[model samples]
Target: MQSFGTSARVGYDSSAFYDRKIYAEPEEVEDGSSEENAVPELNRLYAHSSSSMHELPDNSVHLMVTSPPYNVGKDYDEDMSVEEYRRFLTEVWEETYRVLVHGGRACINVANVGRRPYLPLSAFITADMIDVGFLMRGQIIWNKQASAGSSCAWGSWRSPSNPVLRDVHEYILVFSKGDFARQKPECEQKQATIGRDNFLEWTKSVWEFAAESA
Candidate 1:
């Protein structure tokens, strides 16, 4: 398995990719009523919890996106055994399934680790999610444009005897609770529309992007 550095550094400047405004302006209110023009307050919770989520209600969440610990001796992972790691993830997923709505979606971003044994973390998580009663909705490949120079292990280096393949991408596994389609009211449907450029690009299975600098 590979180890990561703990030092903090300046991250890559990705503002160029996000500066464009793709969303169209909201329609002007014909009646000009205060309520029609009012923007709803967005209540957000930003907290960190490794285990049970007591704050959230059962079947209340519409979507969940998470990038859990990889159990690869990271500073935050506490060096858990493989079985212990699996159990920990299972518990978290069970809690996630309980809090999701009937047709809510869960997206998990994960990458494989190790070169000798080749631990497929994403596949293991997929099985665990299925065991927790989540329907698999396929996955997206996030090509993070990994640099070969970053990896220290090259096996035989230049020889074909044992060449290690560099992992340049990660998996974004998607799952739905109970049903494939999420149920929404007519009023909320308008808010769910995707931008034209985003719709075309996001629909593809492969997403090419740069990795965040440390």
Candidate 2:
């Protein structure tokens, strides 16, 4: 695979790198068809997302679901200020908007951070996505019932002083590019139907589920 870009920072121009051979070359067929006409093998690329996204053609992806880093000193997270984090997210969302199809949907699962001053990360991301020309869709609340009692921080302990609320839920912000309804072929429409019971349950706003085990 060609090196798309060495830098992991956001907004880095990776146009200097070339070659779309990130995926495996399709096997040659028995017929006289050339490799150019062969379908490329689907493979995962482990690289910078912004750099890798540049390789994809515009209006190619149908759906995108992502959970960005919380930037709360996680091992894999970089130490960035709130402004820097907002810029990073905006750059990524811009790339997402470029790659998505006309009616493609982007779902972001995020939670607000409980720092010195509470950070509404999901709200910030929603604004950023809107600024990139994505239409606002409804948001889903993922209520993690199992983690309701996980936090023991009760500021002032029953006094009427400063108190902090424990967060046991996350927000899934949905947005679409260009249009609200995704255009699909008849065959895909038949295959994508959800069951009646599931559809009814999933359409509601709040979803009760347990948190994933670390």
Candidate 3:
């Protein structure tokens, strides 16, 4: 469970950290080979982490960002009650907040998920994030093209026909660890005050980005 890092140099003993021996209670991993491979994978992800943010020195991480697993019940390996899921996320974000620098920013590219029984997943998640102390910034819409709308439908509450039209939009929620800027007004304001030499067309929520564009 030893970690090492300072500026440029960093490394870890993946084998020790992922040692199944320590977590034997969770059923001994009789298959030793799979566990061995997972060790290196762990190292690759946390190679830059400095002691769970606490050991890394204060305000060390410039950018803390991740795409949290969209819990659409698409084989996330857990069917936990939404409350439990929220708790898990609570811990994850608490740690993230602890590590983020005073001015450091955290961006979670999360999409909403909705299954039977539960209601709007994104709406609930959005509320939970704000409750967890992260300042809510404006959301970015990603109108990506991915086949046709599945019979599964999108997360937001909608109908076959609505005024909003088809939900070709996904959410890229922008949240900060603390009382951070609601939006990066500098970029927005600068674009305004600095003045654009070119014509500025109004942008819509729906974006049509393609893998291959002209």
Q: RMSD of candidate 1 to the true fold?
A: 15.7
lDDT of 3 by residue, 55-158 (tens): 44343344666766555556644667778777766676667655554444666665554434435555666777666666665666766666434443454355
The clash count of every prediction, one per candidate, is 0, 0, 0
- C-alpha RMSD of candidate 2: 16.8
Cα lDDT computed for each candidate against the true fold: 0.75, 0.75, 0.51
- How many angstroms is residue 42 displaced in model 2 relative to the true structure, after the best TM-score fit? 3.1
Instruction: Tell me which residue pairs clash in candidate 2.
Output: none
Write one digit per residue (lDDT tens) for candidate 2, span 94-186.
Answer: 888777776778999999997578899999998888777788788999999776665546564565576667788999999888776665755
Q: For every model shown, what is its TM-score relative to the native structure?
A: 0.74, 0.75, 0.52
Query: Can you rank all candidates by TM-score, best first?
Result: 2, 1, 3
Off by over 4 Å in 1: 1-50, 146-154, 191-193
Residue-level lDDT of model 1, residues 1-214, one tens digit each, is: 2223424554555444445464243222121111111112237564767368776766667788999889877677778877888998999899988777677789999999997799999999999998787888899999887432465464556767777888889999999887766657556666546788999899889988777763
**Shift in Å, residue 25, candidate 2:** 47
Worst 10 residues of 3 by lDDT: 29-38
